[model samples]
Target: MTTQNLLVELFVEELPPKALQKLGNAFANVLFDQLKVRGLTAADSVVTFFASPRRLAAHVTNVLERAADKDVLVKLMPVAVAIKDGKPTDALRKKLANEGRAHLADLWPNAVDGPDSLVVQSDGKADAVYLRGIAIGGTLQVGLEFALNEAIAKLPIPKVMSYQLETDCELPGWTSVNFVRPAHGLVALHGSTVVAVKALGLTAGNSTQGHRFEAVVSPVVLQDADSYAATLRKDGAVIASFAERKAEIARQLAAAAAKVGNGARPIEDEALLDEVTALVERPNVVICQFEEQFLGVPQECLILTMKANQKYFPLLDAAGKLTNKFLVVSNISPEDTIFVTGGNERVVRPRLADAKFFFDQDRKKTLASRVEGLGKVVYHNKLGTQGERVERVRAIAKAIASQLGDAQLVQDADLAAQLAKTDLVTDMVGEFPELQGIMGGYYALNDGLGETVANAIEDHYKPRFAGDALPRNTAGVVVALADKLETLVGMFGIGNLPTGDRDPFALRRHALGVIRMLVEKDLPLDLNALLAGAVPAFGDKITDASAQLADFIYDRLAGSLREQGYSAQEVDAVLALRPQRLALVEKQLAAVRAFAALPESPALAAANKRVGNILKKAEVEGPVDAHVNPELLQEKAEQDLFAALQRFVPEANAQFDAGDYTASLQTLAVLRAPVDAFFDDVMVNAEQLDVRMNRLGLLKMLHNAMNRVADLSRLAV
Candidate 1:
C-alpha cells in the first residue's frame, strides 16, 4: 500500500484568543485520532497542527488513500441456541438475514471453513457460534468525511455562534450552522488530490484566504500538502503555524526591546503572549511610549492595564521597574511604523491616565474612611456584609496575634484586618477588582499608617493561589491566617461546602491557603485551637463547625503532601495522628519513611498492628491502663520486652521532646526483636483476668511509644 502526505484546513473568522491554542490542538488531534481509528492512517503516520487567527489546519505524513481489508470474527449466538440437531434454527437464520448474510444460512451446513465460515468457540460462559468474514475496507473519501465530522463535533469550542448559510436559487431556503466562528472554506488534500469532504456546509478545496490585508494573493492556492505553510507565508503573507508565529513575535519583541537599550526587556507573561499570538497572522513588533507621569501609579496597575486592556507588553528595567516604553504586536507590518506606534501610544495614554486618576482620587480618602462604605457592599448574604466580615476577621486576627506576638503585633494585625476590605469600595479597585487588596496597601501608606501596616494590608491576601508567596511580615501572617480561617469556618458553618467541581466560593482554595500559611509559616499555633478561636468572632452568625473545618484542612494538607511526591501510605500514617503542628508533618513523614526501610520494619509493623487489634478487643471489656506490673510478668518473653522498653522508651521520649522525630523512631527500632519475641512466645488473652489485663497494659505502652511520630500499624501492608 502506498501512502501520501495529507493536509486539511478550516478557514474561519477570528477565533477567541484565549482558547485558540487549545482549540487548534483539539481540532488536529481529533482529526488524526479519527483517521487512525478508521485505519486510514499508516503505522508511522505523524501529524503537525497549525492555528492562526483565521484558520486551523493539520498536515499528516504517511496517510493511506484507503484502509486495508481486515479479518473479523463476530460472535453470532451460543452454539446451543444456534444449532438444533446439527442444523441451523429459525433464530440463526433470522440473525444471518438481519446481518445481510441470508445466503450464509444455506451455506452453513456444507461450508465449514472458508472466507465466510461459522465456527464454535467459548465466550467464557458458553460455547458460541462465531462468524468469520473478511470486512471490506473503506475508501479515503468516506473515511475522511467521517473523520471531518467527528473532529468538528469534538472541538473544544468555548462558545458557539449560529449563522445562516446563503443558499443557491435551487435550494431557496436558508440553513443555520453553528460553530466557534463562521467558517468560510475547508481544504482537505491527499497529496495534490482534493478529498471529497465537507464540514459546516463548506466543501473541501485546495484554496484558502490568508492575511486580511497583507496577503499578496486574494486566495492562497496550495499546490501540494507539503506546500501549505510556505505558500501561505509567501503569497498569503501569513505565518500559518501558531507556535511559529508566537516564537516570531517573541523574537521581535526581544529585538525591539534591545533597540530601546537601557537594560530594558518586555514584561514576561505567557498568557498575554499567547493571546496576542492568536489575534494576528503575521506579527510586527512596534515600540510605543507614554508620559513618565503615569509611573507615579503602582506598576502593577499600569502593567495590568497595558497587558489586559491593550494587549501590549510593558518593558521593565534591569531592576524590574516598569518603563514608559511598551511593545505592541501588530498584524500589519508597514515599512514606516511611526503611525502604528503613534496610534498605539495615543490609545494607551488615556488608559494609564485613568488608572493614575483613580489612584490619586482614591488616596484622597484614607482607608479608614472607606471602612464605612463596605457596609453597603455585600460579601455574602448569609455570612453578612463586608463591614461585618471585616469585624470578624479583625477579631480572629487579634486572637491569632496575641498567641504568636507581642502587643504591638496584635495592634498592627487588627488595624490591617479592619482596613483590608475597605479598598473594595475604592474607585480604582471597583474598576479593577483584581487590585482590591493592592489598592488598600497604597492607601495605608498614604494615610501615614506606616509601612508595617501597609505591607500587612497588602500581604493579607497573599497566597491567593497555589504556590503563591505568603505574607512578608509577622503582622501580615497573623492577618492572612485570620482572613482565610474566617472564610473557611464561616462557609463550612453555613453548609456551603464544595461539592464535586462546583466551588463557587473557591472554598478548596481558601482551605489550602489556610493550610499553606499554617504549615509553611510554622506558626506554633494548634490547628484545633485556631479553628476554635475563629468561631467566637462569628458569634451566632455561624455554627461551631470547627471539627468539620479541621478535617477539611487536614485533608487538603494530605493531598498537598502527596502532590509533593510522598507515597500515600506515608501521608496516611503521619496524617492519621492528626498532628497539631502541620509544620512537623513533613519531618514525621521522613521519619516514617526511614523506619519503614529498616530490616525490622515489616515484623515490627505487623506486631504493632497485632497489638492494636488486641488492645481494641481488650478495651471492650474495660479500659486497659498502660501501667504494667513488674511482678505480673510471668513469661520470659514478657519480662524481656518490659526491660527493653525501660531501656529505650525514655531515650525515644527525650528525642521526641527535642523535635528529633527521625532519631526518636530510629531509637525505637532496637525494640523490634523483643516485640516480635513477645508476640511469638506469649499468649495475650490468658485465662486469668489479671494476667490478661497485664498483657494488654504492656501492649498499650508499646502502642503509645511507637505512635508518637506516626502510626506504624498503617505500614503493616
Candidate 2:
C-alpha cells in the first residue's frame, strides 16, 4: 500500500463561537479514528486539526491510498444443513449467496473426523459442517467517503441548521441536510489527488475560500495536502490553524497593552480569549477607550460588559484594576484606524451606560428592603419560596455560628444569611446573575453596613467552584456552610438525589463544597451532626435523609482525597471508621500511611484482619464480651499479647490525646510481635465456652485499641 498525507476541509457559515473548537476536534478525531479502523492509517499516524469561524479541517499524515488486504473469516451454515454426501447443500448455497460468495460454494472441502472437524451434528452426530471464506480490501475512494459521512454524523453540534442544496445532475430535486451551519464547500486532497468523496450534497475538491474579505482569489486552490496552511496564510490572507490564530491574537493583545505603558496588561481570561479567537479570521487588535467616568461602576461590571457584550479585552493596571482603554480583535485591517476605533467606541458606550445605570439604581434601596420580594420567587415546588428558604438558611447559620463563636458572630451570620438572596432581585444582579453576591456586598456597604457583614454577605457563595477561595471570615464560613448543607439535605430528602449526570441543582458541587470547607478549612463541625441539624430547618417539606447525605458527603470526600494523591488503600482505611470530625481525616490518613510503611506493618495488618474475622464469626451466638478475664489467659502467647496490649495501648492513647497521631500509631507498632505470636499459637475458638469468650474479648479489646485512628484491618494486603 502507498501512503501520503491527507487534508480535508468543510467550509460553512459562521459556527457557534463556544462550540467551534469542540466541533472541529470531534470532526477531525472521528474521521481519523474511522480511517484507522478501516486499516487506512496506522496507530502512530499524526493528525492535525484546524477550526475557524467558517471552516472545520483536518490534516492526517501516513494515510494509505488503499487499505491493505486481510483474511477475514466469513462463517457459513452449520454441518447438518451445510453439506450432504461430502458436498455443499442448498442451505449452505443460500448462505454463500447472501454473502456474495456463491461462486465459491462448490470449493468448500469435505468434513474432517472429530471435534476439530468441520462437520459435527447438533445431536452429537458427524453431520455439522461450518464453511469460511476471505474478504478483499477497500479502496481510498470508498473508505474516505465512509469516513467523511461518519465524521459528519458524529460532530458535536450544539444546534443543527437545516438547509436545502441544489441537486447534482444525477438527482434532479433539492436535498435537505442538517449540519452545524449551512455547508458551502468541501476540500479533500490526498497528496494532490482529490479523494472521490461527497458530503452535504457536495463532491470533494481541492479548493476552499479563506478570509472572506482578504482573500486574493474567490476560492484559493490548494496544490497539495502539505501546502494548505502556508497557501491560506499567503494568498488567502487567513491563519488556517486555530492554535496559530489564538497565539497570534495573544501576541497582538500583549503588544497593544504594552503600547499604553504604566504596567498595563490585557485581562487574562482563557475562555474569553478562545471565544474571541473563534469570532475572527484575520485578527487585527485595535486599541479603543471609553469615558473614564464609567470606571465609577464596579470593575467586575465593566470588565464583564466589555468581554461579554462587546467581545473586547479590558486592559488592567499594575494593581489588576480595569482601566479605561480596551483592545478589540478586528477581522479586517483598515488603512485609517480612526474609523474602526471610533465605531467600536460608539458601539460600546451604550453597553457601559446600561451597566452604570443598573449599578446606580441597585444602590437606591438597602438589601434589607429587598427581603420581602423573595417571597414571590419560588425556590422549588416542594421546597417553598426563596423567603422560606432564607429562613431555613438563617436558622442553620445561627446554630453553626453559636457553636463556632460568640453572640456577635451569630448575629452577623444571621444578618448575612437573611440578605444573601436579596440581591437576586436587585437591578444589577437581575441584569447579570453572575454578579449576585458581588452586588449584595456593594449595596451593603452603601447602606452603611460594616465591612464584616458586607464581606459575609458577599462571600457566602465563595468557593462556588473547584479551587475557588473560601469565605473570608468565621461568620462567612458559617453562613456558606449552612447554605450548602441546606441545599444538599433538602435535595436528598425530597428524592431529588442526583442520578448519573442529571444533577440540575449542582448537588455534587454543593457536596464537594461542604467537603472542601470541612477538610480544607479544618472546621471542627461534625459532618453527620451538620446534616442532622440542616434537615430540621426544612420543616415538613423534607424527609430525614441525614444518613444518606452523610454517605454522599463521605463518598465525595474519599474521591477528593484520592485525587489529592492518597492511595486507594490508605483512603479506605481511614474512612472506614466514619470519623465524625472530618477535619481530622487527613491527619488520620497521614498516620495510617506512616504506619503502613513500618517494617512490622504487614504482619500486624494481617493479624488484625484475622482477629476481625474471628470476632465476626464468634458474635453470631451472642455479643462477645468486651471485658477480658485476665485469669483465663491460659496460653503463654495469649498472656504475652495481653501484657503487651496493657502496656502499649495507654501510651498510644496518650499520644493520640496529645494530637500526635503519627506517634500514637508508631507506639502501637510495638505490639506487632506479640499480636503475631497470639494469632500463631492461641486458638481463639477454644473447646471451653468461658475460655473462648475470654479470648474473643481479648481480641476485641486489642481491635478497639488498634483502630482508634484508622481501621488497620483495611491495610492488609
Candidate 3:
C-alpha cells in the first residue's frame, strides 16, 4: 500500500488560553484515532499536535491515501427460505432487494462464499445463508472529512463562541456556527496534495495564515506534511509547535531574569506557563518592575494578582522572597522594547495597589472585631451561620486539647478555633477566598494575640489537599482536627453524606485530613471518642451519625492504605480489628506482613479461619470461658494444643501490652504445629457434650490470642 504523512490545521481567532492545551491534544488524538479506525492509517502512525493563540493543527505520519479493501461476511436468513426449488424465491428476492443486491441474485452463489454452497445446515433444520466478499476501502478524502468533523465536535472547549459566515453556494445567506473561536481557515493535506474536506464553512487548502503581525508572507503555504513546522517557523515567523514555543519562552524568561542579576529567577508555575504560551505565537520575555512599596502587601496577594490577572511571572530572590520586578511574555519583538515593558508596568500598578489597599484596610480592624460579622455570613443553609459553626468547632477543639494537654493549650486552641473562620468576613479574604485562614493569622498578630494563637488560626486549615503539610503545633493540630470533624459530623448528621463524585461539602477531604492528623501526629487520641465528643456538640439539632461516620472514615482509610501499596489482604486483616489508634495501623500492617512470611503461616492462617467458623457455628451461650479442665481433654492433640496455648498466650499478651506488635505476632508462628494437629485429630463437635464444649473453648482461646494485632484468618488465602 502507498502511504504518506497527513497535515491538518484550523485557523481561528484567539482561543481561551487556559483550555487551549487540552483542546489541541483532544483534536489531534481524536482525528488520528478516527482515521485509524477507518483503516486510513497504519498501526505505527505517529501524530504531532500543534497549538498556538490563533491555530490548532496536527501532523500524522504513515497515513494512507486510501485504505486497502477488506473481506466482509454478511449473514442472511436460513437457507431453506432462500434456496426454494433451487431458484431464487420471493423471500430471497425481498431480502436481496432490501440490501440493494436484487440484480446479483443470479450470481449470488458465484459472487463469493467459497466452494461451499451458500446453504449451511444447523440443527438438521435451520441453515443460515452466508455471503463473503471484498468491501471497498475508504479514501483519504472521505476519511479525513469524517475525522475532521469528529475531532472538532469532540474538542474540550471550555466555552463556545458563536459566529456567522456566508454559505459557499448561489443561494447564499449567513449560517451560524458555535466553536471555541471563529475559525477562519482550515488546511488538510496528504503528502503534497490537498484533501477534500470542509469545516466551519471553509474548504480545506494547503495554505494558512501565520503570526498576525510578524508573518513574512500573508499566507504560509505548506509543501508537505513533513515541511509544515519548518515552513511556518521560517516564512511565518511563528513557532507552530506548542512545546517548542513554551520551551523558547522558558529559555527567554530564564535569560531575562539572569540579566536582572541578584540571583533573581522567575517564579515557576506550569499552569501559568501553559496559559502564557497559549497567548503568544512568538514569545519575547520582557522584564518589568513596579514600585518597591507595593511589596508591603503579602507576597501571596501580589503573586496571585500578577499571575491570575495579568498573566505575568513574578521574580523571586534566592531567599524565596518576592521582588518588585516581574517578567512579562509578549508576542512581538522590536528593536527598542521600552514601550512593551513600560506598558505592562503601568497596567499592573493598579492591580497591586488594590491588593495593598485590601491588605491595609483588612488590618485596620482586628480579627477580634470580625467575630461578630461571621454571624451574618452563611456557612451552610442546613448548618446555620459560620458563627455557629465556629462555636461547634471551638467546643470540639477545647475538648480535644483538654484530652491532650494542660489548661494553656486548651485556651490557645479555643481562641484559635474561635478566630479561624472570622477571616472569611475580612476584606482581603472576601476578595480572595484562598486567603481566608492566612489573613486571619495576620489580623490576629495585629490584635496583639500570642504567636501560638495566630499560628494556630492559620494552621487550622492545614492539610487542605493531598500532600499539603499538617498543623505545626499541638494547639494547631487540635483546632485543625476539630474544625474538620465538625464539618464531617454536622453534614453527616443531616444525612448529607457524599454520593459518588458529588461531595459538595468536601466530606472526603475532611475525613482524610482527620485520618492524617491522627496517624501522622500519633496523638494517642481515640478516633471514636473524638467523633463521639463531636456528635454531642451538635446538641440534638442533628441525628446521631457517629457509627456511620466511623464506618465512612474506616472505608477511606482502607482505600488510602491500598493506594500506599499495601495488599488488599494485608489491609483487610489489619483493619478488621478496627483498632482505635490509627497511628498503630501501619505498625499492625507491618506486623501482619512479617507474620505471613513465616514458613508455618499458611497452616496457622487456615487453622485460625477454621476455628473462627466453628466458634461462629456453635454460637456458644455467654462468653465461653477459655479455661479448660485438664481432665476433660480426651485426646492427645487437644491436650498438646492446650499446653502450647498456656505457655504462649501470656508471652504474646505481654508483648502486645508492651507495644511490640511485630514480635507479638511472630511469636504465634510456633502454634501452627499444635493447632494443625488438634484440628486434624480432634472433632470439635464430638457427641460427648463436655468434650465438644472444652474443644470449642480451646479454639476460642486460640482465636483471641492470634488476632490481637490483626485478623489472621484474613490471610488464609
Estimate the Cα RMSD of every predicted model relative to the unseen true structure.
Answer: 1.2, 3.0, 2.4
Q: What is the C-alpha lDDT of each candidate?
A: 0.91, 0.89, 0.89
**Please, what are the lDDT tens digits per residue for candidate 2 over residues 529-645?**
888988779879889989888888889999999999999999999999999988898899999999999998998899889989998998888888778888999999999989998
Tens digit per residue, CA lDDT, model 1, 1-717:
999999999999999999999988998999999999989998889999999999999999998998999999889999889999988999999987787676787876664545787778899999998888888889888988898888889999999999999775696899899999999999999999999798888899999998899999988899999999999999999999999999999999999999999999999999999999999999999989999999999998999899889999999999999999999999999999999989999999999999999999988888889889889988998988989999999999999999998999999999999998898888898889998788889889999999999999999988899989999999999988888888899999999899988999888898898888888888898899989988988889889988998898888898999999999999998999999998888889999999999998898888888889988887887899999999999999999999999999999999999999999999999998899899889999899989988988999999999999998999998
Compute the lDDT of residue 548 as modeled in candidate 2: 86
Winner by TM-score between candidate 2 and candidate 1: 1
Question: Model 1, stretches more than 4 Å misplaced?
Answer: 112-114
TM-score of every prediction relative to native? 0.99, 0.96, 0.95
Clash pairs for candidate 2: 79-128, 79-129, 80-128, 119-128, 120-128
Q: How well does model 2 score by local distance difference test?
A: 0.89
> For residues 1-717, could you state the per-residue lDDT of candidate 3 as single tens digits?
979999999999998988989998999999999999999998889999999999999999999998998876567678877787777678877876676666656765554334323434464566767554577898989989999999999998888888999887799699999999999899998999999799888899999998889999988999988899899999998998999999999999999989999999999999999999999998999999999999888899999889989999999998999999999999999988999999999999999999999999988888888889989988888889989999999999989999999999999999999999988987788788888788888889889997899889999998989999998899999999999999999998999989988999899999999999999999888878989989888887799899999999999999999999999999999999888999999999999889988998889898889888888878755566666888999999999999999999899999999989999988878998888888789888899888888888888889999999999999998
